[model samples]
Target: MHSLPPLAALKAFFVACHAGSYTAAARELYITHGAVSRHIQVVEKWFGVNLFIKQGQRRVPTPYALTLARELGGAFDTLSDIALRYGNGGRNNVFNVSVPTTLSLKWLLPRLDDFYARFPDANLQISTANTEQLHIIGHYDLLIRRETSGTEYSAIPFLQDHHCLMASPALLKRHAIERPIDIFSCPRIETLTRPGQWNLWLKAAGLDKSAGNGIRRYDHFHVSLHAMLEGIGVGLGPINTLSQEISRGNLQPLFAKITVAPNQYYALTPVGVQKTLLHRAFEDWLVSQGQRDIKLADLPL
Candidate 1:
């Protein structure tokens, strides 16, 4: 560590590379572009190499810069997490959760009345975003994600289901889905933002590849579900989220055999957070209820 680059310069280089621009990185750090540039220059000088390649108007990072960026990004995020955890000297009973909006709305939201009933003293907050930003891992007490695994905490397999082609009774009746092959004559299927999901679901239902053409797609499941709920068209999506509507006779499942989605439901939290009584009771209840739907070794759908 005798002749190391200045920490500021190192940090600036990391931010610039990670953010893909000196200006954006500077804005995040609340500093001048000149200051960030100077720091990058200092780091480059100390390394005796170029960290970034200038192309016409764009700043492209070199191979060396990419590797360092991730480490520094993690470092900065870790520091932020620690700062917030220590800074918050709040009541012990407060709990926070984050989940994707569609999952929260369809499965978790309608269901949280029970959690509150079980742990009346605990205050709960839920956020609905899928990505685990570094700050969130430290801030949120529990996070619901549709992922294959968990990172730092224990993961509970909450709910599992396959993607089903479904639509409002109003739409299906008009379109008339008498068989899987009949889908081609109907309105194009809708899906969450994930690419190729419609094609996969159609193929699973034994329809020909021609059946997959011209399918409309959206990124968020909420959008797709909303489209289906409003009688827009058939949608390929999770069964659990659409359960209530189907039960209410407002929607109809096109096929009972669904195409599997890679991610089911997972509970993520830091180590020991679930052990707390506030979280424990809710976790136990949630898992027991979910077990009725999901089993690890068997084919889930």
Candidate 2:
């Protein structure tokens, strides 16, 4: 017989580590914070090590806890895939995808008609979730995400995530922002989730951190982009996400010569499953369409 911690304890530990708090885990698991705490304690006692430490009113996962959580997450993902594929007798020709909302709005939705035209028989169902939780790999057949280093799944690079400063034409003219440094005089729109984006882009452009002043923060990139479009301030815009806006003249690029090293958009599939015909067809179609979009966006007026 195999010995292991109780399944409930393992699940609580996984959710707590991922959610970053017992309360959040409790909400997600439909349990109380006290129950979440007790389950974690059970796991910690079974392992004879502390999984989390109290840090200034927050429960932070230890390094060991993070490692264990990642492993457990992967195991759960595999089990989910198996159950979805076999236990329920998987549906035919239906492809489910998880994507970030901003990407869905700015990039994917615009070109979906072409996807359907090419693959009429394929029923594509897309769901959106917070980008941070994407590492969990739920029931979706595929996930489109910003490429991160060292992922366990098979990934196909779809779009280059080149970033640059973007602002409405009205804002630029109003601020007389002729140069990159001039942007500091105007409000700087920021995405709360990617706090370091402005810093990284400014550093790459050879500007000091102080140049990113007059800040307005938004919880999501889409909101920040909307604020920028409303002539609120300049924002760091990734090419894949903002290309259509630039093309439509809703927003214009600033300091075009100064660009950051491109990150990538990836189409991630479960490990060892990329060889399937349906997965390959969709990946190929997606990549080809993305390449076309990038080419058109990169062209000079």
Tens digit of per-residue lDDT, candidate 2, span 1-301 = 8999998999999999999999899999999999999999999999999999999998989999999999998888777656555554554555778888888888888888887887787667788866646655456778887764465677888877777888898897799877668888899998988778888888877789874558999999888988999999998887667777878998888776566647778888766453456678889988887777554245442
User: For residues 33-100, could you state the per-residue lDDT of candidate 1 as single tens digits?
Assistant: 88988998898888788888887886768988898787777777766655544465744455667877
Best by TM-score: 2
Off by more than 4 A, model 2: 1-91, 148-151, 272-276, 295-301
Clashes of 2: 0
TM-score of 1: 0.63
C-alpha TM-scores of all predictions = 0.63, 0.66
Candidate 1 collision pairs? 99-128, 193-218, 193-219
Candidate achieving the largest lDDT: 2
